[model samples]
Target chain A: MGKKTNLVGEIIQDPKVKPLSPHLQVYRPQITSVLSITHRMTGVVLSVGSLGLASWIIAGAFGEQVFSVAQLIISYWISQLLLFAWTLCLFYHLLNGIRHLFWDAGKGLEISQVTWSGWFVVSSACVLNIIFWLIAYGFFAKLV
Target chain B: MAREGVSHWWYQRLTAVALAPLTLWFVWSTIQLMGVDLAGFRAWLSGPVNLVLSTLFVCTLFYHMKLGIQVIIEDYVHDHVLNSLGLIATNIVSVVFCVLTVVSIFVIVFGS
Candidate 1:
C-alpha cells in the first residue's frame, strides 16, 4: 500500500479497531452541546455586529451630518430589530463566556452542575436583556 | 505550536475577563446617553474616564473577537488554503475595526 492509502487500508481491514465515536448528528440534543454551539453562534453574530459599531463611531467622528445619517438608519424598525438581537446576543455570549471562564478554572465540571448553569445562563441573559432595553427606553429613569 | 496554543488560550480568557465589565459599562453608558445629540455624545465620550475605558474596550474586544473567529475557522474550514485565508481575513477585519474605532475616538476627542 502506498503511504497515503496504507493507514486507510489497514484501518478498514482491521475488525478489532472499533468504529470511531458517533458523529454530531448521531447524538441526541442536550443542554451542554446546544449551549456550546449557541456560544459559537453568538460569537459570530457579535463579530459581524462589530461592523455596525465601527460604522457608528466612524460616522460620529466624521461630524454631525454623517452621524445623523447613522442615527436615521438606526431609527428604522429593521435596524432596531437587529440592534435588539445584537444586544441579546451580547448578553448571552457574555454570560456563557463567564461560564466558560469557570470551566477553564476547573470548576463546574459535574454533569448536573453544567445543566443547571446552562439554564441559569439562559434565564439571566434574557432578564438582563429586558432590563437593558428598559433602561434604554427610560423606564427606570422615569422611576428615579 | 504548543507554546502558541497556550498563549492563545491564555489571552482569550484574559480578554474575556476584561470584557465582561467593560461591556456592562458600555451598555450602562449607552442607556445614559440615549437621546443625546451628536455633540453631546461626542463630549461624553471625550471625557477622561469614558475615553480611557472606551479605548481599552475597543482594543480588547477586537483582539478577543479575532481569536474567537480564528478558532471557528480552524474548526470548520477543512481546506488548507481556505483555512489560511480565513485566518488572514479574521486578522485584517479585527485590526481594521480596532484601528477605525480608536481613530474615531481620537478624532472626536482631539480633532477640530
Candidate 2:
C-alpha cells in the first residue's frame, strides 16, 4: 500500500500527467472545429507547396534545358494529381484567409455566419478547382 | 520578448493583407503559364513590373509562412528543446529558400 501511495504520488507530480483540453478525436466534429483544423492543415500544405513554386522559378533561371526537364517531371499523372491537390489547397487557403480577415474586422463570429462561411469556403474551393483544371487541360493544352 | 507573440500575429495578418491581391496576380499568371515553355516563361517574367512584383510576392510569402508555421510548431510540440529547434530550423529553411527563389527570379529577369 505504501509503494502504491508513492507511485500515485509520483504520477500526480508528473507535469505530463495533467489534464489536457479535449482534443479533436474526443468530440464529434462540427463545422467550426472541422474548419479550424483544416485551416491549420492547409497552412502547412501551402508551406510545402511554396517549395514547388520556388522550384519552378529556379528552373526558369537555369535556362531551357533545366526548365524543360523540371516541366517534364511535373507532367506525369501523379505529379498532376499532386498539383491538383496543391491547387485545392491554394484556393481553400485564399478563401479561408478572406474569411479570417472578415473575422479580424469583427464580423462572422456568430455560429450561423461561421457555418455559412465554412460551407462557402469548401464549395468554392471545389468548384474553382474543377474549373481551373478544365481550363488547364483544355485551353492550355488545346486538347478539349 | 513579452511582445513577441503579438508581433508575430500582427505581421502574419499584415502580410496576409498584402498577399491577397498579390496572390491573385500570381495565380492568374501561373495559369497563363500552362502551355508556356522555358523561353516563354522567361519572357513573361522578364517584364520589369512582373519581376518587381514577383520579388515582393516571394519575400512576403515566405515571411508570412514562417511566422504562421512557427505557431503550429509551438502549439503542437510539447518538448521544450524540440520546439525551439523546430522554430530555428523553420526560420533557416525559409530564409534559405526565399533567397534562392529571389535570386533565381532576378537572374532570369536580368541575366537573360
Candidate 3:
C-alpha cells in the first residue's frame, strides 16, 4: 500500500510552517509595552508592600518604645522617599488591576482602545499619587 | 483532580475581587492612621469587625502573592533546580509573612 500514513511520518517536521501569531520578539515598544510590564512589576512590588505593612504591624506589637525606634527610621528623608515609591507602586498596581479586570471582561482589546487606556492608567497613577501626597502634607500642616 | 490550572486561575480572580474593596478601605484607613501611635493603632485593630477584615485581608493578599510568584517563577526560570528552589522559597516567605503578622495581631489583641 502507498498510504505512507505511519505515526512516525505524521510526526515529521514542517519547518516551512510560520508561527500563527506574533510574540514579544516581534513587537515594538509603546505605551502599552511599558504599561504591560509595569503591571507585573507592580504585582511584585505590592507583595513586598504586604510584607512592609505586616512588619509595621509587628513593630507596633513590640510596644511603644520599640515602635518609636522603627518610627524614627521611617521619619528620615530616605525612608520618606522609599515610602513615596512604595505608595506609587501600590497605586499603580491597584489601577492596573482594575484595568486587567476590564480586559478580562473582553473590553479594550483593540489597538486604539488599549493605547488610550494605557495612557489613562499612567496618568491616573501619577495624578492619584500627587493627590495622596498633597493630602498627607495638608494633614501634617493641620497637625502642627 | 479538577484541573489545577483552573483552580489557580479561579483563586487569582477570587482573591483579586476580595482585594479590590479591601485595598480601598486599607488606603483610607492608613491615611486616617497618619500620626497615630501604637496605642491608637492597637485600638483601631481591637474591634471585632476589624479583626475579621484584617485577617481576611492578610490571608487573601498573601495567598494571591504566592500564586502570582509561582506563575512568574514557572514561566521565567527554565532551570529545573532553580525553578523549584524559587517556588519553595516563595512559599516559605508567604507563609512566614502571614504567620508572623497574624500572630502579632493576635498577641496585641490577647496576650499569651
Per-candidate clashes, comma-separated: 0, 0, 0
Q: What lDDT tens digits, residue by residue, belong to model 1 across residues A31-74?
A: 99999999999999999998898788888889988888888898
Best by lDDT: 1
In order, the first chain's TM-score in every candidate is 0.83, 0.82, 0.76
> What is the per-candidate TM-score for chain B?
0.95, 0.94, 0.93
Each model's lDDT comes to: 0.91, 0.88, 0.83
Question: Candidate 2 chain A: minimum summed lDDT over ten consecutive residues — where?
Answer: A3-12
Model 1 residue runs over 4 Å out of place are A1-20, A142-144
TM-score of 2: 0.89
Each candidate's interface RMSD (Å, one decimal) is: 1.0, 1.1, 1.2
Displacement of residue B9 (Cα, Å) in model 3 is 1.2
Compute the interface RMSD for candidate 3: 1.2
* Cα lDDT of model 2 by residue, A2-111, tens digit: 33336447533455567678675789989888888898899999999898879988888898888888889888999899999988988998899999999999999998
Instruction: Return whichever of 2 and 3 wins on DockQ.
Output: 2
